[model samples]
Target: MTTANFVDRPATAPIGEDLRGRVAFVTGGTRGIGAAISRSLAWQGATVAAGYGSHTAHAEQFRADLAGELQGHAECSVHQGNVGLPDDCRRTINEVIEQHGRLDILINNAGINIDKIVLKMSDDDWMKVLAVNLSGAFFLTQAALKHMVERGSGRIVYVSSLAGEIGNIGQANYASSKSGLFGLTKTVAREAAFQLERAGKLTDTGLGITVNTVTPGYVATEMLASVPEKVIDKVKSSIPLRRLGRPDEIARVVHFLASDASSYITGQVWGVNGGIDM
Candidate 1:
């Protein structure tokens, strides 16, 4: 190709794609990895609806941060709802569509970890983890699928964990929920592809709406604060990189999946575990 034909673009182009007018919904978007994902999407020009369950103060602070950091490059609004509840999921999805006029991306990042040995775990603990981590993703995706299928394009990225891939001690409930998301991601990818084909919207590569998962290893977040420092040190030692993955590192992968660069990619799990899974 001629030099003139090869247009050199800056490495930082907002969102790596021209998502100037898209709409995205991120669950648990007020903190940690979800916050990074929300900011990344917003920076790329998508109007973001950040969903949070509790943590009103944290959520409000996140909104303020976005307002200051984004500087009107994009819009981000906070919505309160528990993804575990079907009613809340439905209502939240409806609210996003009503406000933004469309929904293009759905990030199932809301999750809770209740670490307890299987023998000692309570029914409430197991159920709560699964409901929030696994079922919530399904409920939200189901609610958003209608709009995506009608529009014939969408992106769904589930936030899984390395614990799900390689089971962690005293995290049976959390592991199961994260593993369940793998199945959910693949199934949804196939179904959405079928729908797009039926609608005569499939690309030449037979691709349409994409569904994927991102598995992150240890990260320095409030969630990790619950872990004993000694345990974290042990984890760091185990990792080949001898470090924890950053939320933004995981968000970068999510951004790629959310962008047009990953148009032909679906039903995949991108791990950001700093060689821990190797």
Candidate 2:
């Protein structure tokens, strides 16, 4: 009996350089977990488009670091956009496609949180969080999906939060937005499969579209700077690992999902939390 082409790879084969020729677009790619993700993917060989919001100086620095100090096997470019706006999402997607000619991976890691209890949350706070975290992901995915569907190959990964799975205090809007990603991931995975099948690209060894979500627990980043030290200590004690997660830790999982090695996995939520959900 002969094995299928896609199944013929050696079990012990190294998959580290699998993304050598791929192109990735990472929103919020200038800082925090997103920056780490950009670095991780680029290190593995993917040319990256690092999307940032209104941080020109920071974005420039990030681009410089990628192009100079952190230079590796990949080329990295930075793009600016307010993900909360649909126009910005579409525009940035176009820019990446034009710059790279093709986009093989889409990392919807751009998100914002407006921390306010249900009663204390104002209309702007709710809408702003939803627009950036949930709506931005949808718009960006919508744009990228069209291109991916036409090419019949793509990987989409949404970075969510543990707060989405288990409610967080003073973060009703933020939690809701992240939770929405679960439904989006599953639906996009199913729809991409169906579309590829219809296009005759869903062959036994060819089709490669996949969509998944990565939910990280509290990580050490600038986002945590505003939290009181006492609260930080308490958060650390509550985690099973008794410490905050590192950005690279989450980025590694994301790098896997963005690689061909993860072709068989999709529509799943990977929790990179320190056993927080468990």
Candidate 3:
């Protein structure tokens, strides 16, 4: 609430190098928006653990390319896990900590969508979406929280969707899962603050454990590869920006939220949707 509270806070590094000496874990980090997020964080000097589900080849390629591009400036390792499984989520977090020694950032970006109207949507479709998108984020965050709280510093960012804010016609399952992230964000933010304070980690300068969400509009990713061109055109026209969002654009917002610059921010849903109305 006041500048005095923020003075003298320790940072991982200077603003530009804020992520130096930090480690981040990104779910679904091998492709699409998730890949962009992993790259952005690593570029800022964070060692990243990128999680993938079934795409072994794609994940390996991403790791190789990112490593080559960074050229030892940063480190990225790929981990395989089904985020929807609670045990897998916990194991992934433990593995990252075991490898990197610490995890300072968590990006819950793994998600899947099965488009179907409510009436036509089967229970499997709805449950699958929620399992991967909503439940997975929760379990991953839960596993990461203890470590982050013990260290007295961390960042958690949920990558949501614009459809969560403004419902889509045939994506009831996907929209529900995405919207669920909003409640999860707010609740976790409060709990993290409370736990930090209880552990004597909270101070006038802030402990820096923060939880937030980033909702992106239609991004030009493989996710849209199957959509008809005409439908894509119509969707773009509906957006005020007259184009689908880019992965990097979403990543930029995520980059900020995961940095020390966002220490004072939490429990908020940031829209990076090219001016699309909520």
Candidate 4:
């Protein structure tokens, strides 16, 4: 019998370098896809302030891991705040700007899902999902835009879902909130472009400030841990790749949108799904 050796591989190669000297704030940055994004940005030499709603231990662990991964090449810190709250959103953005002296990227990755069929969903379930997924992004953008517009440069990326692009079973509220992000991204992009144009800082290739969204599909995250095995199998079968998306796979796309390489990309939706909806 011959012994076989196996080597673990990262989902994607690390990319991006122009992020050095930049500051990024990511909501829900402690775990799952948000954690991957935080690590990705920091690894690229950006100062990252990761905001988490709760889970102090998880956030602390993520911060430690980020520091280890960067090994003094970047700065990564964790902040506690609830994106769903207006006051918290304002305060979080203010603190990040005050601490970093500038904000270059804002990634709205915080979201919650209260999955229930429309007939069984309560008003609270519907409103809470919208409050966190949709309104939270809106409020944070409003707060961050003031600084970005003043500087005439910024990047905003919203983490949407495939459920938003297409209807999903038992995700009425989640789907609606995610869908609202599309409108928000486009409107913000248009407004920011206009501002840059007036300042004579806009180029045909890119705006002074760019806004975009990343829609991930069936990612293997803690959020999916509760999903039934049968459902997971069914979803896997539906995907062309026949596997769940890794957080890093989604993070790489986000890293691109956050970096200077994607300056020409704005108001666009980049899907990181395993060709599930295609």
Candidate 1 backbone collisions, by pair: none
Better of 2 and 4 by lDDT: 2
Model 2, position 149: C-alpha lDDT score: 93
Clashing pairs in 2: none
lDDT of 3: 0.88
Reference-based TM-score of each model: 0.92, 0.92, 0.92, 0.92
Candidate 2 residue lDDT tens string, 212-260: 9999998877767677888888888889998788787888899999988
Candidate 4's TM-score reads 0.92
Candidate 3's TM-score reads 0.92
- State residue 95's C-alpha deviation in candidate 2, in Å: 0.6
Count of backbone clashes for each model? 0, 0, 0, 0
- Give the number of colliding residue pairs in candidate 2: 0
RMSD of every candidate to native, in Å, equals 7.3, 8.5, 8.0, 3.8
Model 1, 21-103: lDDT tens per residue?
88999999878888888888888888999999998998998888887877777889999998889999999999999999999
lDDT measured at residue 147 in model 1 versus the true structure, 0 to 100: 94
Tens digit of per-residue lDDT, candidate 4, span 1-278 = 00011011232445346689999999998778888888788878899999999889988987887788677888888899988899999999999999989999999999999989999999999999999999999999999998998888999999999999997999999999999999999999999888888878787655379999999998887666767888888888999998888788888899889988888889999988989887
Ten residues in a row with the worst lDDT in model 4? 1-10
